[model samples]
Target: MSVTRRSLLAAGAVAFSGALGPLFASGRARASAHGYGPLLPDPGGLLDLPAGFSYRVLSRAGDPLRSGEGTVPSHCDGMAAFGAGGGRVRLVRNHENRADAALRVPAVDGLTYDPGALGGCTVLELDPGGGLAAERVGLAGTAVNCAGGRTPWNTWLSCEETEDRAGASGYARDHGYVFEVDPADPHRLGAVPLTAMGRFAHEAVAVDPYRGVVYETEDAFVRPFGLFYRFLPARPLGGPGSLRAGGVLEALRVPGVPDLSVVDRPGAEFPVEWVRVPDPSAAGTPIRFQDFGPGGITHAQKLEGCYWGGTGVYFVSSYARGSEGAAADHHGQVWSYDPRRGRLRLEVRFGPAADVRLPGDSPDNICLAPDGGLMVCEDGGGEQYVFGVTPAGEVYPVARNAQDIGGPGAPAWGEFAGVTFSPDARTMYVNAYTPGTTFAVTGPWR
Candidate 1:
């Protein structure tokens, strides 16, 4: 079964897959000139990009979808791009809205899962020239639809970032599960949560195509922080609905490294192991709180964007501050895990310096660029930007969020999300978190 956006809403479920892409531009002179060079301000005052590049606002919140059933939702978060054949493309987007939000995803009949919840996903089909062709809601009525991963079989794993349970805060069913959205078929009705994937403050997931294992990250920030997880599904490469069959959820343990925040140096390597989570459902308590022997499972703060690349999975730790009760402080960190060798390596660390302009701190959604580098989205305070990081750890700004949503004196900087490239690597698609807007960027991509 394939899962493309249009196919999912019109039929039932369909599947499609494509590689994900860049991130924070560093303040270094050399890094600044590496990618497309300095960002040329956008006269429209929305997104600022380099000289040869241009962007178009494909869709915005409140705009009527092509289906005419409802309008585009707010707080667009994680997204993936898939080829729609005939040189066209389709995008599966997530809306991270809460139940109380003024603008919520419309609960279309049969397509919605929860009547009281207000988060889900929207699908946009772009023409070969990067023009909007069609738009519709692919999934609906899920809470806090946050970052998720793209399956090798071409389906999107839309994750609920909240752990709100049934009978709590107007919720009718338990949240915090991964729901698969097929962009290839549009006929499926009702959303089914993948319970075997575990229930926590889910952030993002990365699928190991070879082993058919799904790795997940938790973004919970409390006394226990969050734990990295891996779901060993019952059926490997079984396509859509396979994950629902069941799986064993386990947490990563970096031996003696109880807290990931303490690791400041890049290139740090540690042998790792996975401990089975006693309760993947988190029926009574969260998976992170459960006992994992004396050694315990390793934890990190703000565990966010995850993607599969190279020999393993690459995940991000947005930022850590000692004042916030973390072990050590750092602007940001990117770690890569090589499952083949059972080893974890920290590839990038923002700094010992407090400068946000240096490496663009608090990096959020990330992807491996077509140019063999990494592209990252910044979610920190002040001006937000999408940056690119070369294999050498050098950074350059790919795009900047120049949207003046606050009017006059108050300039609002909305963080960029859902950074992914087309299958042909000719166009880039991204989202602005607030005053939701999806941009289709085309330029001289090197």
Candidate 2:
């Protein structure tokens, strides 16, 4: 039942290739020329791109910094780039750690968190040529920063993806929430968590400007499925500093499908919508029980990477199957939600079962290339790798951690997580968590 890019395109043509199909429906489109073959080995131990591609390591974990900050933490997760004054690039990166272990905050003046485990968030200024200009800690004392989206006003929303209410230690209030950090500010902003965004295991956030809606995904890997949530800002264009004010939170529920079980073979045309769910922690709530599966399902999956491109919001589900039951339908799905058309459709699927055999389910963040293709971070095995897929649905490896610096097992940090392009779309920057490093790469494609 695995679907390949070629097969998916064929299916789309037969099912809805009219005016509704993707813009790249016809193979004659310019997207066809952007095709990239599989990865080839390079003698320099760097990513081997097509004839015109080249890469350079910009920043590495434990590397000395002019900011006087100590060593960068391992587990680098989500990140966002901004245009700094004087045509420099500012990047805000998140360190996903629960604070339960040793805290590795750099020695920056205003950077360290209280519990020490407030994972690291650093704002580094880079030159247009991909050189580090300046660096500072954006926020500190946050826990398990999984993934977050960038604000149109030039800020990064770093999310703490944890809900450890009761454990060996006591409960930490407001631990699982989203924090807004200003890359330009050397000191931490307000350190305020947007409670209105709902308290859950958040994986990533995607903002829709046209609808003024913020789409978010949960990463509950334990019991219930993760849930897809949408936050409606009380005011349109809540501006840059209005996230903590208030908003409405709603979950996703497929109507007409009673049993609501995960669909293993969800058709490309499966319909979905944002459904309101009662807050589990509501005061007057009397009964509480464990509810898994699709119907009466309280959550969705560990949705990792998300991006707004090609006239829609593209999101990925890191975990396709849970111990509760068989995977709903497919493993690692790329879904496109067109706000204008008010519809959601499956664009591609990845995993061992899919036609294209990817490394594993450890898909982290994603970015659309200037050539109109998709770049993915493979976070599964310790042998982390980055993948690039063409519009024609060709998947190939772009980079791998063969240098042995990432260590044995592919720990969360230091693994390749976030991928973004320069403002001119001529350069690509990739970051890893464990060893904490950022690589600047340029190729013929640019």
Off by over 4 Å in 2: 1-51, 100-103, 107-113, 166-173, 186-188, 256-261, 264-267, 280-298, 322-324, 327-329, 356-360, 405-414
On lDDT, the candidate that comes out on top is 1
User: How does each model score on lDDT?
Assistant: 0.81, 0.62
TM-score top scorer: 1
TM-score of 1: 0.91
Cα displacement (Å) at residue 24, model 1: 17
**How many residue pairs clash per model?**
36, 33
* TM-score, one value per model: 0.91, 0.82
Q: Per-residue lDDT for 251-302 in model 2, tens only? A: 6655654322253343355566665546633223211122323555334456
Please state the error at residue 324 of candidate 2 in Å. 5.0
